[model samples]
Structure formats: structure tokens, C-alpha cells
Target: MRDFPSRRRGWWARQTPRRRVFFLALGTLTVLIAVGVGAGVGVQRRKDNGPAYLVDPTTPSGPPPDAYPPNPSPNGTVWQPQANSTWQIVLGSPITIASTATSTVPDVDMFDIDLFGNSASTIATLHKLNKKVICYFSAGSYEPKRPDSGDFKKSDMGKELAGWPGEYWLDVRSSNVRDIMLKRLQLAQRKGCDGVDPDNMDGYANDNGLSLTSDDSIAFMTYLSSAATSLSLAIGLKNSLDIIPEVVNMTHFAVNEQCVQYNECKTYTPYLDADKPIFHIEYPSNSPQLSAGDVSNSCNTRVDPVSYGAGGGTGTLSTLLKKMNLDGWVQYCDGKSSTTPTES
Candidate 1:
């Protein structure tokens, strides 16, 4: 989500010199107005949730060893998603799954939703309709609103994310953090999730304020992949492009965002080459009322002879045109749009 709040402007919007200067002046004015109003502009507030508690108390704590065993995959029986698999991701809220319904509104093969927001019953309902459930969570950031937010130690946090308030980059190397993430993984397994989509794994690529490196991300993926494989849950590599070659073999699929807009879709072709689905998302300007030019640009762009996988071939992406907030509304390359019913 471009490391920002859901409603914030896209990075591409500020690339022009005119917009950059305008935003700079606007930012200065906003800061000045905040100071005049005696408001805490950049401070992060932690929720009063009594005390830090583990999400999955039965799961063991502590970080895994530096070098762990290889993931039991490709040979092991895990749910491996194929290329060009149709899907929908709605993190803005939980989707409403009717028990008696024969299929979802979009009738996609997969549904990726917030891990904490969804219940096991919801996942089971999706399963009844023969849809795979991919639970979504942030593995490399501390979000204060999460149920297990208090579980994170103060020392385990770095600087706040630039545009996302109350969210801070996490020290992925910390045992406490890894322990918390392990519990999250266990929660996903317990919730009957077919797979887990762990976001913010690319903290090393941002101004994380923690001296995070690409090597640390690679190691973190290793740790997560081992735990997920053990739980018989498929895990996806989320936007850690720099370490794709290292971790692609371990991960079952790729959950990517803005690859097409950033002209980096080719970077994720490794997953396609491995016969893994690249569940891609693109947030076009003025979405929910997308222009024809915008739709054409998003769906018809070819990187290395690969399109959005309408034909389902090697180097193609299973792309979905979505709003930045990732609500139920979704548009496909075939010019079909549908809104999966979500809980209010």
C-alpha cells in the first residue's frame, strides 16, 4: 500500500516538479497550522489494552535458529496457487459470507482478508463455496489497533511509518517480534486460512529507522516460511523484491501491490517462472470511477511480453484493479467490475 495510510496520495502523483513543490509548501503550512493549534503532529499513541498479551498463548516463543531446515514444499502437500488464479483482497473490512450462498459475488478462486477482522466461521463459509482463504497481516510493522499490539515491546519498534499514523517499523531481528509473528502465523492456521499474506516485509527498502537490511529480510522470510510450512499453510512473499531470488523457492505465491504502476512487474516474473500466482493489485487514479485511459494503461501494459494474464501464460500476473483502501469493489482486465459484499 505504498507504506502509507489507505487514503493518502500515491507516490507517482508527487513525481512532477509542480506537484512536489506544491506538496512541500502545503506540508509546511499544515505543520504550522498544527503547531498553532497545539496539536501533536507526529506523535504515535498506543492503545490502552491493559497489558501486552500473546495472540496465541499455546504457541511457543523465541526466535528460530539462524539457519533452519528447508521449507517442506513442492514435495510436501501444501496448497500451491497456480498462475493467473482469480482472486479478491479486501482489507478495509471483513466480507460477508452467507452460509447458504452457493458462491461469492465475484466468484473468485481466492479471498484475501484481514486475519484479525475475520472469524473462522467466515473462512469456513468461503471454504464451503470452494474458495481459498488467504489471511492478511502485517509482519514487519507495529499497528496499534491490532488485538496483539500490546504484545510488542517498546524496544522492538523503530520510527513511525511516514504516512501511516500509529504504525511503526519493527525490528524483525528481535526475538520478541519474531515470537509475536510466530503466534500470528499460528492464529492464521487456527483460523483455517489456506495461506497467509504477510505485508511490510520490505521495511528494509524504506526509511525504517531500524538499520534493517535486505539480508535481514531474507532471514526473516526463511523463519516465516519454515513455520508456515510446518503448519501446512501456504505463505506468500509480499513485495520484498530485492530478496525474491533467495526466498521465492520457499514461498508458494506472490502478493504484490503497485508493481505495474512502478514499472516493476517484471521483477516478480520469478514467481510466474516457478508456476506460482502473482496476485497483483493496481490502484489507478480516480478509482471506482476509472477513466478508460487509466484502465487501458493498467490492464494493457506489457513488461517483457507479459500482460495481466488474461490469457494465463508464463510471466503474466493475476491482476486486479482496486481502490487504494482495498474495499470490496474490484475491476478486472476484461472490463468486468463487482463489489463483494462486506460487513459494515
Candidate 2:
């Protein structure tokens, strides 16, 4: 065998240089192909397990160390909405209001629309009509369709929000996440929004895989409230009923949904006591064609002890009856309904 190896070496030394070079190149390519296949298998294994970020708890998992300061004096520069203020929220699509139009359909004190869907001119038009504008955005969730969605790192996301596709619960403690929200608040400021309706602030109350707690939500709200105040924008506490007592003083109002259906309307009476408006919404089964029962259930739901007494009187709830999609169609407690025109 030793003699055979020596003979093979001698034969290779005598071969043409081109042939030797070709064999060496072929050997390198074979090794490279093997390595590539092994790497691909490793990646596939990781994918099968889950995203690498999900497995690695590299980011901080709990509320930040610095506790949100005690609720400071109310910012007089920001809008302080009163209790029982009239409003309409059209988040299904952008409302269409012409510059020459005299007034918006279903004229209310304020209009809540999607922050990214509407333009500065639309806000200006609403301003000309003497109506306040509340820009809406998701603060505690990762929405893939948002313009800044790509800014979110995989490490900052957790479980997908139930019943909402392509929307995931965000790690509220992530500094990167808070930075993106600050930018969103800046956008609202530039767009002339009188207030902001930051939705999905109750991630801790859901099955968020990030182990978020009420403290985390409270800290996140503190950050949001501070940022919005600095930008001279009013912020609303959206559906975070568990943390309402902690954050209601910092927020300007409450943008609640389905509180009546969930029998949690009483939880929001704090806003009423603080003279803050509860911009409540209830999604009935047949909206725009609401039955008397639907109207009664939504518009007549008792929220407080005094106004909504045993007689089922209209309370401080800035109530609106609409479809689940939250389109322009709005029905009031007085059995009046109107559809605000929207852009296709």
C-alpha cells in the first residue's frame, strides 16, 4: 500500500497542470456543496422549531427598572376633553371631506380616524369645521401593514393577537418598540391631530407570550403619555381596564370598545369622575339597520350610578352604535343614524 501511494503521487506529479487544477477545483466545489447542504438543514431545523428570536430571551422580559413617576399635573397645553363629549370614530377607512364642504356628515365634536390612512389636509379640513381630530394607531401590537412595521425586530414580538391576522402582541418593554411609538406620536403631531387613540394597550390582559404584566403596561402607558404630552397631543387609554386606575389620570380620555357587551362599562367610571370623556363604542349584530333592541342595548347601556340610573337614562358615555368594522355608519341613542362618506 505504501508503494502504491508513492506511485500515485508520482503519477499525479507527472500529470498536466490543467488536469491537476481541474481536479483541485472539483474537490473544492464538492466540499462547498456539502457544507451548504448542512447549513440549509440547520436553518430548516431552526425554522421548524420556531423563529430564532422566539427561542432566545435575549431582550429584557419585565417592566423597566425606572418606575413611571406619579401622575404629574395635567398638561394645560394638551386637549382636555370633557365628559359626554360627542365624537365619531371611523377607523374602517379614511373619511372623504372636500375642502369646500360646509360640514362633515354626522357632525360631532371630534373625529377619530386612522392616523396613517388620512392626510394632513383632511385633518385641516376637519379643523376648519371646528371639529377635533383624534388619530388612531396600535401602540402595543405589531401590525404588518403599517408603514413602520418593518422597523420592529423579531425579538420584540410575541404571540399573534387572537382574531386579528398579521397582528402580534409586542414586548412593551422593548426600547426599540417605544422609539417607534415615539415616532408615531410625532407623526400625529405633524398631522395636526388634537388627540391620539392608541389601541391594544391591554396586551398584559391577553395571552401574550412575552410574560407582560400590568406593571409593564403601566410603564408603557407612562412612556406613551409623556411622549404624547411633550408633542402636545392628547392620549386615550384604550381598553386597558385592568390598568385604568393606574393610567387614567395620565391619559386625556378613554377610547373603549364593547365595554357594554363585556359588562365592563362600570370599570371605566373613573374617567367620568375625572371629567374625562369615555368615547365608547358598541358593535351590534346588525348596524346601519339596528333594531330597537340593538339600539337600546348599545345606546342605553348603564355605565354609571347617577346618569344611567335604574330607568336606563343616557349616561356620560359618548356612545356610538356601528358595525364591527367601525365604518362611517353611526347610530345614536335618539334612533338617528347617518353614514359619513368614506374614500373607496
Candidate 3:
């Protein structure tokens, strides 16, 4: 996966010695907040054990269950993609389909594109081509340029995302932030998206100033899944493998980046164990120059068979080779390559 913007040290290293002293003082505040939120949840757990962190026991318990409706209608009918569905993602730019009447390239089942970058017409056009759409948006960070940027209160913002500019980690516990995300889901619902690719769900794993815990991330995702399901839009957990066991049931699928590079693909098999998809992407070292070995390594599934052999070995994953920018250029495991048309 592309390194997250704002390298935790890159930013600090760029600073002069005097400036480093200044930020270290600020980092102390972050430490205090992290300690106050309760420590020990940061340790990564083995796939067999699931996440070391569980939901905070002190959280208020809501009302008990009402029987699920036989045909519980969310805002619309939810469509869950298959575990092995082939897909393409183009988040860097808006795609210019060759023809509005029919798709001419990439015989993939689904297309994941940025929510705000493309319009409802783009989604409608994809529908005509029999392709499913997964709308992507930052669910755990505040992007300053989004139309709803103003919706985030100052208090809701936290440390700048490592390596990313104008983006800040959000306090997922904030009701206001949750409300804004609900509105984004509404937009997805209106645009006829089949599912949502919520990015930055792993803020707790970062040096976020808000002291967000795994419980907080779990709570946020739980709320997002329920909200998306209520809207008839499928929600996929994005890259927060640490809490997969806690939330596998809540999400319809998973979108992973650079799992092979980090050697953590095995940790995400819980999704496949439950018959959910893991849509994986790997940014090749050489853009457009992917070798056969790149394909083999990226597509390899290495998991402990003893722990997860419930008819589902390791996990089901669909790998896509993409440039770090994630434009239209793509290569499959077969080494076949194609570049979708993009507007100049």
C-alpha cells in the first residue's frame, strides 16, 4: 500500500532542531491523551486470537433486541458482492467511459471510485454497463476540501494525518462527525451505489491526537455498518485488520491495501471465513512495469491452514495491481494490463 501521507517521522525530521523541540512538547499532549484513554490495546494480536482490544465495558448499553423484520427494508435493497468478484479502482481521477450506452473496457464486476469526484450520472452510466459501484470516502478523517468540510467542528479535529496534507484524524466518538458521515451515506444511497469503501477506519492505529482506541474504531464502524445497511448500501471494512473479528459480522466485505507488502494478509481471513469478500490492491514498485514475479507475490495467499480451514482456506481475495496514484492503469494476476480512459 502507498505510505500514508504525513510520515510520522518524515514530518518531524524535516523540522529544524529547534522546531523538533517544539513538536516534542506537543507530542507529550498526545501521550497523555493516549495514556488517559487506557493503554495496552495497541498490541497487535495473532489472527487466531483476534484483536487484543474489545469494546469498552463502560459504554452505555442500548435497548435490547426487537425481532429483525422478515424483509427489513433499509432505504433500498442492499447488494453484497461475491467473495471472488473481480474489480477495478480509480480514485485519482474521474473515468471517462468510452460510451455512456455500454462499457468497452475492463470486464470486471465492480468499480470503486471516489464518491465526491464522480457524479450521479457516472454511477448511472456504470449501472447501464452492468457494473456495481463502490463509493469511496474518508470516514475517519476530515478532508478540508470536501463539500462538507465545514461540517466538522474544530474540537472534532485531531493531529494531521501522517504524510497527508490538509487532512486530520477525526474523533470518531463525536456525534457531529458521525452525523456528517451519515449524510455521506445518504449521498451514496442517492447516487445508486451498491456499496461504500470507507477509508481511514484505522485511525486508532495512527498517532492520532484524539486518543482513539480500538473500542472507538469498533464503535464507529458498528455505527457506519448499521447506518449503511439501513440505507440499503453495503459497507466494507477498509484496512483495519486489527478489529476484523470484532466487526466481521457487521461489514459486508473488506478492502485491503498492501497486505502482501506488510505480510498481514493472513489476519484478514476472518472476512472470507464468514463468506465476505476481501478486495485487495497492491501498488507495484514500478508503475506500468509489473513483472511476472510481482503478480505471483501479490496474489500469493499465505495463511496458517490449521487455524482457518472451515471450508474456506486462508481467505478469498481479488488482487489488483495499481500505481500509487490509483489511476485507471491496472494489471491482473495473469499479467494482463489495461488503462481505462480518463478525462484530460
Query: How many clashing pairs per prediction, in order?
Result: 0, 0, 8
Off by over 4 Å in 3: 1-75, 303-307, 311-315
Provide the clash count, candidate 1.
Answer: 0
Over 4 Å off, model 2: 1-76, 305-315
> What are the Cα lDDT values of the candidates?
0.84, 0.85, 0.83
User: Tens digit of lDDT per residue, candidate 2, span 113-164?
Assistant: 9999999999999999999999999999999989999999999999999999
Evaluate model 3: give its lDDT. 0.83
RMSD per prediction, one decimal? Answer: 28.7, 15.9, 27.0
- Candidate 1 residue 8 C-alpha distance from true site, Å: 99
Q: So what's the TM-score on candidate 3? A: 0.76
Question: What's each prediction's TM-score?
Answer: 0.76, 0.75, 0.76
Error of 1 at 109 (Å): 0.5
Write the residue-wise lDDT of candidate 1 on 236-303 in tens digits: 99988899989989999998888878888877766766778888899998898987777888875355
Best model per lDDT: 2
Question: In model 1, which regions exceed 4 Å deviation?
Answer: 1-76, 304-315
lDDT of 2 at 27: 97
